[model samples]
Target: MKIAVLGTGGGARAHIAKLAALGHEVHVGTRDPQATLARTAPDMMGNAPFGQWLADHPGVALHPFGDAAARGELVINGIDGRNAVAALSAVADRLAGKTLIDYAVPYRYDPDLEHPWPTPWGVMPAMEPVDTDSLGEQIQRALPATAVVKSFVTQEQTTVVDPASVAGGDHTMFVAGDDADAKRQTTDLLTAYGWRDVLDLGPLVCARGMEMYAHLHSAIGFGLGQQFGGHFGIKVMR
Candidate 1:
């Protein structure tokens, strides 16, 4: 499978490495490939520099957004939540008739961000389109021809790639999309990553719940004194 992953941060690197390792031809897309490779410092999230990570993974190719999207059989939106639509919009024509796996949460922390350390998990981060719609839905709206599957947004990076490493793979991840074939394809990809419990929440509108779950996810991380560690995941006990 030829996969194009967007973004230059940790999430993009993780996806590129894993998908390439899984024998998929992976290409990473960024606004500017040269600028991305010129990055010398670690990212805001404390992940290694993009240049460094790219050097380690020679099998993955880097290209401009449209070029990558044109070349991919499947596209993964690993870009920041706020920039997803704008970034993908540049490649909208190429993305038509392809499965787009959305893994971004539209939440931004204020500059004066301060967590209450080891107690009640402070206030939730400010998110966009809160009560009315979700980022996933917005992405779908932006690319109506593309099959947008909202997934992999609620877990840590390690958990997204290797679910078995945490909780014995008992936790559940979700897929919400209007297209049944797209959802099935996304499920197969998730299963390849060791995700055992994939629940299709039905229709893209349900993505609002998945996006909002980030609040509870943050609360649990704060309560556990480990911000977004791989030790915890959401499980449906029937």
Candidate 2:
């Protein structure tokens, strides 16, 4: 599959590397390709020198502006929480008829303890509910023609790449999307990226619960010293 990871941060880089490692045609999508290369070149050289050495290798491309948007069969939005909607809007038209893997959380991150995170976990006082009616829903609303599958947001990035190394033994990866075929395709991609256990929580509305898991897990990590070594998982008994 030709996958485009749209963003230029650690998350975006992780997507790029994972796709490359899995033998997918991958592209690093950035508005400023030069800036991404500038920031990434140094780190890739030090931490992943071998991957850096494979810079000239096939199956990976770095694209700027709109070109990256036009090339992908699958577009993964790995941008920051706040910037996801705006950044993705730049290529919304091109995204029509594409299975857009939305890894977004529309939270302000104000550190307010009074709030119950948002809809999906619980409802807001003066606002609407947050499930299929939530932020992911909003993005889907914005791109009606694009098949949006809300996934890859419940667990930490490292956990997604290596479940064995995750603190809580094996974890569950849940997905919510309106399209069954798209969900299945996304599931296959997740499997290739190393997810051993998965749960399909029905429609995209279920993203509310999945997003809430992230908030709760984040709080748990903070309480445990934020060493990036803490995690939470579901246990099912037959």
The lDDT per prediction is 0.86, 0.69
Task: Looking at model 2, report the run of 10 residues with the lowest lDDT sum.
Answer: 120-129
Model 2 scores what on Cα lDDT?
Answer: 0.69
- 10 residues in a row with least lDDT, candidate 1: 115-124
Stretches of model 2 off by over 4 angstroms after superposition: 39-59, 110-132, 167-169, 228-232, 236-238
Q: Which runs of model 1 end up more than 4 angstroms from their true locations?
A: 111-124, 228-230
The candidate that achieves the highest lDDT relative to the unseen native structure:
1
Q: TM-score of model 1 relative to the true fold? A: 0.93
lDDT of 2 at 214: 60
At residue 165, candidate 2 shows an lDDT of: 61
- Candidate 2 at 113: error in angstroms? 7.7
